[model samples]
Target: MIDDAENKEALTSFLQKLVNDSYEAELRRYSSLLATSSRLLTCDSIILVALSSIASLIVDGRVSISREAFIACVCVAALIGASILFSIICQWRIGYKDLASPGEQVKFVEKSWEKLSSDWNIAKSYSKTLDIMYKSVSSRNNKISVLLRISVALLGAALAILLILSLCMINRACAGA
Candidate 1:
């Protein structure tokens, strides 16, 4: 019947648009954030590594700072490394199981269409799907954001420690000389 054809077309269009607007949009947003967060943490690690290498080389070859100051610098570098590692782990944490449930959604849509061919039930299912996917992505993003903040804070703390130790090294060397 023409009515059946029209209803099917309408349902298909609605579902497509709903997926695009809700599921795909959320996915894209989360993916972009994940990538940016990962890059930031990676850059932080690289900087920390470089700073550690430089500091070690300088302290070993040039400066004769106190043992306590040297130890503090090493501890700060270790903590920064740990924080960066945690951020990377958090960024990769996601509900992959939830993401793989499009089959369930498909079944639900089929049942809704078979029962009444009404748009209301199909729309409800689409909305529910969108909500579930959004929640999953949002939860993952929140976790990653927290880790990123912690990583940045640790990085800042490490820099502060580096500055203080460098100053101490300078003062000690000058006083001794």
Candidate 2:
């Protein structure tokens, strides 16, 4: 059992001193990135469903459109499908490294306690943990961010194609009239 004095010392040592202010800010940024990924997933899913529904309606004779426009719609739907895939991949699980399990950390400290010289250095121990976590989290973050960019780019291209196709259809309609 830990004495009251030792417990107090341990609590004080761990009080917000385990992580830097930078890391705290970085955690918020990471959370924002995850939220953005979710929004992308939602938007891509909606666009893909809408495009697919239109294509199906045209195929089933429930909707009538020019052959060129139908083909353009199908092609744009494919683009959105690809974007949806990327967004889903971005939403997949990414393992961010946290501190060691409590049991493991306690055991490590206990084993090293016998060799102690002056006192326990929580900062040094936490720094090493941060080093490992940074490497893992940063790499995962980079991959996720790249996937997000790809999804956004694909979605943009699909929208642009749809816009151009609409303009062409309008111009053709006016000329025919």
Using lDDT, give the best candidate's number.
Answer: 2
Alpha carbon RMSD to native, model 2: 5.7
The TM-scores of all predictions, comma-separated, are: 0.69, 0.78
For model 2, what is the error of residue 29's alpha carbon versus the real structure, in angstroms, after optimal superposition?
2.6
Count clashing residue pairs per candidate: 0, 0
Candidate 1, superposed: residue stretches over 4 Å from native? 1-25, 55-62, 96-106, 114-116, 170-177
The local lDDT score (0 to 100) that residue 47 gets in candidate 2 is: 78
Clashes of 2: 0
Candidate 1 lDDT over residue span 1-177, tens digit each: 225767767876776687667767767777777787787677777878786677877668874546797688677878778777876776775664264467975776666667536565555555665677678777777777687778777777877887888788788779989
Query: Lowest-lDDT window of 10 residues in candidate 2?
Result: 114-123
Clashing pairs in 1: none
How well does candidate 2 score on lDDT at residue 72?
Answer: 80
Error of 2 at 35 (Å): 1.3
Kindly provide the TM-score of model 1 when superposed on the true structure, using C-alpha atoms: 0.69
lDDT of 2 by residue, 85-104 (tens): 88778777777888889999
The lDDT for every candidate, in the order shown, is: 0.71, 0.76
Score candidate 2 by TM-score against the native: 0.78
